[model samples]
Target chain A: MKISRIVSLVIVLIAASYFLVPLYATFQFSLQMLRGQWSFQAYRSVFADPNFLSTLSYSAVTSLVAILISTLIVVPTTYWVRLKMPRVKPVVEFITLLPLIIPPIVIVFGYLRLYGSDSLLPLTVSSAGTNLMLVIGYATLSLPYVFRSVDNGMQTLDIRTLTEAAESLGANRSTIIFRVILPNLRAAIVSGAFLTFSISFGEFVFASLLNRPAFGPYLVQIGQDRAYEPAALAVLSFALTWACMVLMQIFANAKPGASRRRRGAAFNPLARRKTA
Target chain B: MTVADDLLNPPSQGGSARSAPAGLPGAKAPRRANWAWLGLLPFALFAAFFLILPIVYLVTGAFQTPEGTFTFDNLIALTGPAILGSYWLSIKLSLVSALLGAAAGLLLSWALVLGGLPRWVRGAFITFSGVASNFAGIPLAFAFIATIGRLGIVTVLVRELFGFNIYGAGFNLFSFWGLALTYLYFQLPLMVLIITPALDGLKTEWREAAESLGASHAQYWRMVALPVLSPSILGCFLLLFANAFGTLATVYALTGSQFDVVPIMLFAQIRGNVLYNPNLGYALALGMILIAGLSNVLYLVLRSRAERWRA
Candidate 1:
């Protein structure tokens, strides 16, 4: 036991260095832009660049659109599958997991070939159309994460009982979905949205192939041209990922059961109002 | 169970007898199953257009000549030295990185979960793993470059502090081993995130029972724990393998299209930098899909085996 404890300590320390050294090195290197002393010149220069602002915002907006579309597609499908077509649950899950098995490069390659300017559909003929395609590509990439999170959330809810109760109260299907089911799935959707955002924000292969002015390609461009600013961008990207993860953890820890309990408690006042 | 089941799947007469007015007419009951599929139509269409068709196009394209005639020339051409060497190097890099990541991640997870660490340490590691697993691609390459490249902080620090020249010892960050090290950044955390739950599934009572039956620690592991954990461990290794195999941006940034990975070769081909052989590009994509698909299929098989043990 004593030997095991000692081994554990050594393992933890080694793991810590492995994870932290790169981050520390990057942060330290990013400050070397001014030369001879630590300074924020690298960060300031990165933020001041016109390409940085444009590409960052472009990726951010693209990520938001992707998240919205993913939510709209995933929520209804997962809910319907859980409520009615339980037999097709595995099929739906398998389809969503395809993106994981297929690489992004391959997927983008297919997209370019199938939808290039000379293709029949020709979605990549114009900039706006290509941007739309990029959004769809991101939605496809994030399908597994969004669908699984929402499906897990739905697993915690008694959808049948909730549907029956809402039906008895004269609520229509749309009302039950929009007001009842979606409200309950708020935490799951938010967590899935954040995950999608992080993925799309740093995505390079799709954006580069599709010819978009996105943050990922911009970072790669800077990596080739400038040194310290790339390190600065790396630090900023890491922070963005860390922030997304922290938010996801918060939502994940706020499990459905706790919220449901609070909602149940809130119903007592309504019952008292009816009694009075 | 029966009562809940009855509520969920009421008797044919029970539904009409109890709530005929409150629900849709009883006449519409038979049609509900037919129309229920309409709810999934949009998702089905989206998948068919964006997911299924592209793959179908590639698979068919792989066998066609430029004139639309059927031929396996593209696939046969894959035997050329450059393409074959790229695939070989990619497989080697992926295999080494996956093994290295899996072993280290297994040890780290074991240390956190079973090594009698503080409770908060487990939480911290799991949270950090979630972030690090997603922290890949371009910025990851930049981080590695800033840490271990020719003029990197760690390189300078090692030289100045310990009088050891890392590059002088022939460790170039642009080489195969360096790329594997960079891949490990994401691969290790991914392994931890995946295998932690599997390790948690290892019940303490099983270990106690093994001990009480007069088995040594090594015997307990080899005879029982290992047999159970092998499925999860092996499955995670394949997942890590496929992950490293498909990676593009990190390697592209680190090596600048100089390295000969399958993905980089395919990237150049797609950009029309190589001779514009669209059919050959399809074959290349097909080869990549086949490798990734085969690994995932094996992973699913092993995962099912792991699930059986849990049951």
Candidate 2:
């Protein structure tokens, strides 16, 4: 047992090293000032350029806008399906989840065919609407994660009670939805929003196909046109992605504990044995 | 997984909720948006417009001639030599990458779940995996450039220090093996995420009990843990296969369309001027979608099997 464990430990370390090499090397390359010297020139070069910063910021704005739109679509739909028309839950779920199941290229191909040239609709290439469509694609990319999380959250809460309580007080429909249900499902919303933001921020497919002024295309341009600088930018992208992913894991993990808390309070002793 | 499982139980759910409200019952649902599905309509609309309709056009158009006659020429062209070679290559690449990813992920998950690590270290590994996994298409290609490209840092350093060029050593990144290696960056981490839960599901008691019963470490793992984790390991492998099969962005960025893997070839046929047969491209896409659909069907079957086991 001891010998096997030692072997496993050694193997794990080697795999870890293999997995982390590109990350470490990218950092190493980025930190070099002279040919072999350690310096912050890469960081300076990245920040010194207005184009890079503007493009990254532009990508961030798209992500946020996409998140807002997703929230607008997902939250109410999820809430309504759970509370009233529970039958359509599967259809809603299917539509939202289809993007993940389909190959991204197929979807992107579909996008280009539908809007790319003078074929289908009145499509202005690279217009704001084009950018908006990119966000819509991103939101679709993230729908599964958000929908699952929020739908899970809705299951744990006493929605009927909360709604009745609010309605009895003469709160309007919009106020009840925006103020009450949204607040309860906040964590899932944050998780979904953050997921959309991270994915959209790193998105390459729609952004590239659409030729939008986004971080993905910007990185691609930097890599092909200017290799070393793109390495430095890749490090920056890695850091941003690393941070957001941790936040996502934290959200996914907390879900179980949160549901347990709600159920614990609601379940009587009889229900405990029944559940167990 | 909680919601994912619940959604899978279609029999327990309602039917034809097209315009019905599915939220809290306090608010009466006779309003315009509140009639049934106010918020979800836009997303469904979004899916239909961008995701559904385009694919409908792209795939359906494959069956028609350029002048509008429905025909199987596009589908027939799928079995041609050029396409058959590329399809075989794409499937081969997908299988190799997914299996390689599964092996790497099994090790990584062992380190993550059972191998002891400090909270911060575990946190870092998990975070790094998520970022690295999601960091698939664009930035990964960029990182590989700095680290592995012909004039990349490692290649350059190899020349100056040891007078050995890895590219000259026949480790090319612009070829088949190169594309596979690039894919490992995303595939391995994703497999780790998917397989970790299954590894975690393995009971430590079983290992300890097996050991105390005079079983060797190999016996404990081979007879006990491997069997226990086999379903997830299998499911995750297929998921990775599906993922790699459909991938467009990473390989495209790495080798351009010079590689001519199925997705790239399909993209070239439809989108690239060089391949002017859009109908043929649609037929290729149909094949791709059929494979994707098969994988999902496998997921459903396996997922239900998972439920049965638990039950």
Candidate 3:
């Protein structure tokens, strides 16, 4: 028994070292100059760099825009597919999952050929064009999450009953969709958006290929040049990514159980009704 | 379980909201037609310009010239002994890492499932795996460098106490082995994430029945467990293979793409100013897409088979 316990403990320690120790080392490395002197000079260089702030903001803005585009695209499509085109559901799913199926290298190469200045659509090889490709790639890359979550949400709903209820109350079709169904679909959409942003923020291949100075590029550049800041960036990115995942889980958890709990909370009529 | 449960029964059947009432014969008709028709556009346009067009062009690039021609020369060039070495080397590295990952995950899952404290360990295992699996690419490469790179603490420690300089002792982080070791970070977590669910897919009755029939541990695992989990295991392997195979930017940042991996080979064409072989680059891209796509199709088939077997 003791032997087994000791073996298990050893495994756990090894596993922890395997995962966490490297990250700690990177942090220490990023905090110093390459000459073995501990200094914040690397971070100072990183922050003082001209290209960084733009990359940061551009990435943020592009991620937001891409998530918005995907939301506008995914939500309605998921709804319509669930309602009417159930037979073509597999095709829709394949379209959504094509990004994962297509390797990033191929996609990046195609973008250069298809979207470069010499190509049909003349999006200049600047931040905007790069952002456009990034948006397109990020949107499609995120489709699986967005579609699955929204589709999953739609599946739980009785669309006919909900529409009937709202319609009888004189809600227009547009109002019923925008107001009633969409509000209820919030959890799924929020989760999808957060996941997309998390992914886009850390996206490497697309940013590198496009030569877009984004957060991912910044991290890479720092890693190549300085040490400590890259570690700081990694930890920061990890925290940011973790926060997004936690947010997604929280939102995902806010489904049937959350509604029930809210209803249960609302059972106290004297609490906030007229008190509303 | 919550997600799986929610997936089995989701919000599309909620207590409220429905379409316009069936008044005239065409009332439901146009609503269904319009909404459904409109939904197809976004999916179609996006898939066309981005997915299909790009892929078709990429494939064509391998064969056609900037002027115009058809040839297999590009493909021929890629399969030469020199390129083949790197290709095989990449395959070897990804295979080793995948195997290592699988072994680690299998042992960890076994421990969590059979241990006295299942939930606590399982929860921690899964949560950490989820975070770590997604925590790869450039940042991870940097982390490894910081921890184990030249002048890193580990390197310094080894140099002082063990009379071995990791960098000087031929432990080059820019080498093939270095890249593979770095890849192990993502591979292990990925295996844990993918295989845990697969392990759960193993119904407890198989083990019990095998035990009741007087089978030894190895016998039961070989006869019952292996067959049951084969598809997911295969799918997991393909995923790891494609992941390591398609990796760029991360390894490039570390080694400057000189190690001649397929991803690096293609990327060299993309970024090369000297050779300027766009056709070769495109063909290489097509080869990459085909490799990844075929693997995904295999993954889908295997995953479906597993689902059917489970059912």
Measured by DockQ, the strongest candidate is: 1
By lDDT: ranked, best first: 1, 2, 3
Q: Which digits, one per residue and each the tens of the lDDT, describe model 1 over residues B1-311?
A: 23333334333224455545646566645554566687798899989989889998888999999788999899999999988998999899999999999999999999998898889988778778777888888898999999999999999999999999999999999999999898888888888877877788899899999999999999998998888899999998998888888888889989978998999999899886484788998999999999988887788778777877666
Residue B169: error of model 3 in Å?
3.9
**Docking verdict class for candidate 2:** acceptable
Q: Answer with 2 or 3, whichever has the higher DockQ.
A: 2
Candidate 2 lDDT, tens digit per residue, A146-173? 7766776777777767776776786655
Best by TM-score: 1
TM-score of the second chain for every model? 0.90, 0.79, 0.84
**Global Cα RMSD, each model:** 7.7, 8.1, 8.6
Q: How far out, in Å, is residue B307 in model 2?
A: 4.7
Residue A138 shift from truth in candidate 2, angstroms: 1.8
Of the pair 1 and 3, which is ahead by TM-score? 1
- TM-scores for all candidates: the values are 0.92, 0.84, 0.86
Report how far off residue B31 is in candidate 1 (Å).
Answer: 3.3
Q: Write the per-residue lDDT of candidate 2 for residues B176-264, one digit (tens) a residue.
A: 78778888887777777666656766777888999999999789989998877777677777777877887776777787778878888
**What's the candidate order when arranged by decreasing TM-score?**
1, 3, 2
lDDT tens digits by residue: candidate 3, B43-140: 78887887788888888878977576888887887787866787787678767777777777666665665544437766776667656666677777
Model 1 steric clash pairs:
none
Model 3, position B48, has a per-residue lDDT of 86
